[model samples]
Target: METIQFIHSGWAYIVLIVLVIATFNALIKFFGNKEFDAKDFRISLFTLITMHIQLLFGIILWFTKGYFDEMSVGEVMKNDAVRKLAVEHPATMLIAVALVTIGYSKHKKKLVSKPKFKVLAIFYTIALALVLYMIPWNQWF
Candidate 1:
């Protein structure tokens, strides 16, 4: 359990770094009217892969922690810190992952450079925002 937590915590840095890079790359290209090429595709794909792996780690950590077994839903929700760690973090991260998945899929379907970048830019930015917002900054640092 400790190992899982450590890995999940460590992997979060990679996920955040890739997500930021991908989001910024898409936004910059979209605004600059740059062509979407193989490199761009690879970056976005890599970000997606990293995020999915993080999600898997998170799920495993959540189960291993036995949060639900430790407390009732009401009991967990009553405490701010517990609620944040047990519920809010997981739910928000899940949504962020879903956004990344959707963005990747949408970008793939678009044939034009501008549209592809636009899709990735919008979706990834939102997902990045959520990820940034929900991260347990104090704990991680």
Candidate 2:
């Protein structure tokens, strides 16, 4: 459990950095009317892979948490700390991940360069905001 937690925590940094890079790259390229080239594709793919890795680690961490045999759902939710970790954090993060996934796929479907960047920029920016919001600040670093 500790190992899983540590992995999740440590992997989050890579996820964050890659996400930031991907989001900014998209936004800048979109505004500059630059072509979506190999570098852009690679960065977005890297961010997706990093986040998915963290997601897997987090799921393992959650399973090891013993939420199944312990307190009632209502009881868990009533406690602010528990609710944030067990419910809010995961829920919000999942949404953020979905946003990134959507952005990646949507951009791929766009035949035009500027539209592809626009799709990436909007989706990634939204996802980045959600991820940043969901991070457990005090417990995390």
Candidate 3:
């Protein structure tokens, strides 16, 4: 369980860095009127992959903790920290990953560069925001 938690925490750095890079890349290219190329595709794909991997680790860690095994849903919910860790963070991250997935799929379906970048920028930005918000910054060390 500790190992899984450590892995999840460590992998979060990669997820965050790649997400930032991908989001900024899209935003810059979209506004700068640059063509989306292979590099752009690769970065977005990498971000998606990393995020999914992190999500997997997180889910594993969550189960390993077994919060519900010891406490009721209401008990978990009443405790702010526990609720944030067991519910809010995971749920938000799931939605963020879903957003990234949707954005990637939508971009691929677009025929033009601007639309692709636009889609990526919009979706990645929102996902990034949610990720940033839900992250347990106090426990990240």
Clashing pairs in 3: none
- Name the better of 2 and 3 by TM-score: 3
Considering TM-score, where higher is better, how would the candidates rank from best to worst?
Answer: 3, 1, 2
- lDDT score for residue 107 of model 3: 96
- For candidate 3, lDDT tens digit of each residue in 1-141? 989998999999999999999999999999999988999999999999999899899889999999999999999999999999999999999999999999999999999999999999999999999999999999996
lDDT for position 103 in model 2: 90
What does candidate 1's lDDT look like per residue over 38-141, in tens digits?
99999999999999999999999999988889799999999999999999999999999999999999999999999999999999999999999999999996
TM-score of 1: 0.98
Candidate 3: Cα lDDT at 76: 99
lDDT of 2 by residue, 5-52 (tens): 988998998999999999999999999999888998999889888887
Give per-model TM-scores: 0.98, 0.97, 0.99
RMSD over all Cα atoms, model 3: 0.5
Question: Which lDDT values do the candidates have, in the order given?
Answer: 0.96, 0.90, 0.96
